[model samples]
Target: MPTSNWNIMVKASQNPPFAAENYSIAEIKNEVLLQIRSGKDFPVTSAAISLIGQLTSEQEVPVAELANVVLGDYGLTSKLLKLINSVYYLRFGEVTTVSRAIVLLGTDHLRDVALSFTLFERLQTDASDHIINLLCRAVYAAVVGRRIASQTGYTNPEEAFICSLFHTLGEMLTAYYAPGTYAALSKGITGSGAEESARVRTSLLYLSLGKEIAQSWRFPARIVCCMEKPTVKMSEHDDVYRLSCIASGANEVAHIVEESLDPEDRQRKLEKTLKNVHLSASLISGNGDLTAPVEDVHKYCSLYGITFERSAIARSLNQRREENEQAQGPLKRPTNNTAEDAPFDLPPNFNGSSSSPFSSLPEAQDDSETVFTNGLREVGDAFLEECPLDDLLTIILETMYRGLKPFGLRRTLLLIRDARRPAMEVRLSLGDPLASIKSWFSIPITAIGSDVFNIALSEQKHLFVNDSTVPPIDGQPLIPSWLVEHIDRPVAMGVLPLHIKRVSIGMIYLEGEKNFFTTVPQNYLNYVKILHQQAAIAIRQR
Candidate 1:
């Protein structure tokens, strides 16, 4: 359908891709340690902190002077001045000085200016998507800040808006410093063949980077907190969290017409995200008269030269109604299955028998096939319609664990998309006390240093580790080592790629006992595939 909603176009299930540098914190830490050991001067943390203050100040700073302060030994003032005048910064009049521009932006904004300049100066290289992406983000953030100020009530809304806009700074920095780590994460998630989950995982990874960088820069505690929990945190009084939420929400809405999203899906996702973040639905409904007289949301959009119409609200709302009707109607799954629908057969059990789920059948033959038996199909369907999205996922994982018990598989790990961190977060754990930690920090899946991550994600294929002697994937070596050494307990593990359509969603890790396949069954792989399909749909709705 021709919809004007950006969120629907972007797909809430798939968060925008973020550079996975943040989730690569361990690698960064290692680099820091090595630099310290080698006595090589690492980038001074103080420099990052100082740069923030300088950028926010109102000094009309020149690019050269700004560069001088940030780049330290570099005398690239002229080049910087040129960059400042580029089409990116909408400065008119023949004011050729970087200092003048700095003054106009004000000290409060100088932090962002300095940050923008310093980041570009340090990381600008041919084909470096990190700096380019950060610049795009800066421009996007500034515009978002301006529009948010016009649309909402808050003192110094511009300042608050700007802060919210650059919330993903850490991700850029991490991407620049550690491209390998970021690539690994991207590959692991995308290779999983679930585009939706891949994007969300990327976003989570990006958020993690932003949190780290914000902390590294020692920006305000509230700003840091807001960056960490952009969609989940509560602020004290009129804080950045509120302003950022509104900005993000507005950005989502604005993008619908300006970008692409099924207006209906956009509204639905926004509604849910806002509720999840504890924002009063009234505010997002655009009924709150918080907008100020000087504030021109349309003008702000114009300043950025992006097409946005205030009058489109009516159209958007109507589209949303149509969407609700469709959503409420009978469910018909998309027909074109991506890699997620590929077929594979199960292995045989040891007793020279098929060892299927049914005792009469050979062990392998019994366990391999999954039929729509005994209300399982209905249970799955009901689970889809009634269960809360997150709870639905939890139950699905729990069911898989139970299903594997007959084969002696004990532990299972499921990694799902989390927007706050923008990476694959460990959703549930069958065993292990470490899994209980509520705030399980996510690492870029690509950094796991194992090919298993690649095989599971990219090949959309299952991995069987009988002897644990296999080498690891590019970023997921730990999985193999863990599976092999943990064999003393239960070692049967299966990696299932999850996706909807061509959009990759996420992945599931199932583990049973060492002698798990004593009786292999038919279509066992297909059963898990169904689990992943249902899980993805539930997550998308959530």
Candidate 2:
């Protein structure tokens, strides 16, 4: 470990070099960088990048498509939904599904989100605590930089973010992949003096290499420049310079927050950093707590259903006693990529039904047409060991409800016809999952043709009526008298009689925001019929 002999003194960043056992530190660093630069497969990055690239292409990508891609990587998908619901991106409320997120972010923003996440996901593999901490700091800087840029009237805050986030890519790659070199080079990192500063200055070789990687990826020049020349003057007229200032200023703030002992010092640095970006110095003057950015990161992680390195951080802050109990020995670092924690493998509402209609559909095809389908089949094998027939039936109805969701059907009622009487009773209703059914409990089975529910029941057929399409008879409505009397007003409705083995069980009534059915495609109505038939079979068998 003598300073005079650099070769013998070289120690690894965290562990042994992850290269050919005999390779030197220089060869290891160069080899790893070369692999990332041109190799067809990257140990961690390619799969993430490829998947993200597919999901974020120019064409209109369906929510189903996003969900489908995420099925194989359920934890990743959960993180996406969680991130979408994070405070930064959250617009409305809890987004239980990917399709809902598409509606909110639109395709372009979704693409950006996918890109950001894939980068994060890829870096998570076999990363050391130092690197993970650095990545989180980068993320915090990115978020803070974006906000700072926006407050300063810079147009592309997202560009500012990616540039800033990737600024530490070299350091990250070296720490995990070229540990020997990182270890040796980081040996002199001891002081707040010029000697230490000189050592860090020498470390710029990796940062310079990071810029090359970013450039190779076809990133905008300004973005590449922001990472390369983040020390550019904040007062410059050009967007690149301004962006660099914001990104650099935010990174400095992140570091100050990470290192400062006094809360007031951190607050002062944060205010100064904000002012450097032309943002109001008073913005974050109230809080100097270093954990604020970490909290936001944890909040975002929670949105992704991710509980790992950061989760441990959050829990440790609140569980010093628990941490002490574990302090009896060296602690094993819990990995973030556990397969057991997949958030959407079986959503709470799906009730673990293997017979879900989403199973029968063709495996998601890349042909734009079916690319947007959900991944029920992805986790189709996972279902309740004892899923009762009733749960399956409910799953069918819920499928229909979500299927017709694009058509805006707000209510669907399944009225079963009792053998003892000519009355159709609303045995199951969908809308408010918790609402009482007693109010819509029953309807008489009239013999009239105009009686939508009765005609479907008697004829054992499906009746889909678009009120707008039903021409008026002598200027009077063609709908049944029951609808006119019992309902608030006439609206578009579809009635499908459920039958099994030639015996009538019930009829389904689908109501929508007036004329909702008119816009619904014929294929959708056909699917509804299939669901009705499926439900009937399930009921009869059960």
| Top TM-score prediction, candidate number | 2
Give the lDDT of residue 388 in candidate 1: 48
RMSD in Å for model 2 = 18.3
In candidate 1, position 350 carries an lDDT of 13
lDDT of 1 by residue, 344-385 (tens): 101111121222221221111112123223114533644635
Count of clashes, each model: 87, 6
Which ranges of candidate 2 are over 4 A from the true structure? 1-29, 32-44, 54-72, 153-163, 192-203, 215-225, 234-239, 263-294, 303-542
Global lDDT of each model? 0.45, 0.54
